[model samples]
Target: MTEKQFKKLKYYVIAITILFVVGFLLWEHLNGGILSHHLMHHSDYPSISNWWGLLILPFLAWLSTVRIEKRVTLQPDDAPVKAKILRVVLIGFFGMLVLSLVQSLSFSVGYESVAICLSLGLVVVGLFLPIYRAECIFGYVFGSIFFTGAIIPLIGILVIAGISWFSHVCIKPLVFRVIRAQPQ
Candidate 1:
């Protein structure tokens, strides 16, 4: 996509994110705050308002757009990569949203083991797809904010992102070097 098209897309994403958060807050208000209920009752997981999503999600949208824009500008010829990144971002957002909703709803119905597996599955996916840390982190936290709240998931994603980064940046190259040095 051209720079003009990318700019338009960025604005659209920001607008949609803001509108979604506003609509969610309104729905929560109308429902007497049912959406903001603490999904996990453990003492370690402090009760945080789903309203935090109002700020967090939009901020993530803006930040991701800016970061992607910088990357696209730096490699103007890499249109295929730009499109791939956009696809990954959209997939991550919707995929994680669906996963988080399923996990949260299942847990609410007492399927605690399913929820645990889903959460662990996310970590495993991150390990395997280490290059998409930013997209995954953004999507995971954005999807999680309503059901699981923001702070805890944000913390969890950060930890996962760190490990993914370490593996991607440090370990992967070392392994490649070792493999290349070995006899065929």
Candidate 2:
């Protein structure tokens, strides 16, 4: 969608993210996941969330335009393997979601640039907004924005590209290798 539309969309996504995170912390605080399985085993780091982070993968995959034509499952494996792939994808997605939020917030709040950076998300949002016709407006809301200068947007673009490339190079191939190989 347009830049104005993108800003509106980003705001909505940010709002939801705030609400979800706040509610989660509140819920966990009340429930005592202060020390839980997700806290211990699922975390990539000592300070992180595992629930939505783990499941945000498929949503993330859908969030991006991986291939223009060919579509393949992340890992070539059975149910269990696929499940594991999903988990890894979710963690990876968490990283992206978190970074996007940080970058979005930073650009909106702390940026001093005077340039606009267009994101691939804008294209996707525009396309989807017409196809899905408002049903998927929420997706566009978090698509991407041009809140900062060219440099910040470039930084975001590089960060996203770097993360995706690094994950593909290190994480995906390794996981797929294990999953794709035949058992002895």
Candidate 3:
């Protein structure tokens, strides 16, 4: 896909993300979780909604490229290559989900430190994974850390969000630049 097409596709994926979040909330509400409470605060375990989101996320990422490819299939493009990238991203998402689940379960069992450490570890792994595979790394790393901090009340959310924003704005690009500069 061309850059313009990719930009359009990003908007589509953003829309899908918004819808996924909304659907998650709806699922929570239907299951009797608080509508007023944030979705992350609604549970101690990885929500089914989250699993659903992760399951579809790869498909959406791949499909966006597929749509563009169908319209413009002439170039010596690497759209097909996106399949592997999205799959790796999906693995990262699944890893985060499992780790978050373990963290939540640990919190319920009064092993909060373990949960935080696991989250911190996941963040570190996420930091490296993006150097090799940038697709959805922010969501993987940030989402995992958020789960770790989610149990810490308001301060936790603020801290994780700050870290995520900082990494996204400052660190990720530098890593990408470094990776791009290295021998292929």
Question: Would you estimate the TM-scores of all the predictions?
Answer: 0.83, 0.30, 0.42
- Quote the lDDT for 35 in model 2: 24
- The clash numbers for all candidates, in the given order, read 0, 2, 0
Quantify all predictions' global Cα lDDT against the true fold. 0.74, 0.39, 0.52
Most TM-score-accurate candidate: 1
Candidate 3 weakest lDDT stretch, 10 residues:
145-154
Cα lDDT, model 3, residue 69: 44
In TM-score terms, candidate 3 sits at 0.42
TM-score order, best first, reads 1, 3, 2
Better of 2 and 3 by TM-score: 3
Cα lDDT tens digits, model 1, 1-184, are 7779889998998899899888878887898873544435765655667877878888878887887777667765776877877787678667866777787677778998998898788767766676354556677777766666666677767877777787778878999999999999
Task: Give the distance in Å from residue 90's predicted Cα in candidate 2 to where it truly belongs.
Answer: 1.7
- Output the better candidate (1/3) by TM-score: 1
Which of the two, 2 or 3, has more lDDT?
Answer: 3
Candidate 3 lDDT score relative to the true structure: 0.52
Identify the candidate with maximal lDDT.
1
For model 2, what is the alpha-carbon lDDT of residue 4?
63
Per-residue lDDT of model 2, residues 1-184, tens digit only: 3336535654564456556545554665588653222222235634333343223423333343232011124445356765564454444444434544554565457442311233445333333222221112222223322222122233344444555555656766788899889697
Q: Where does candidate 3 stray beyond 4 Å?
A: 1-76, 131-184
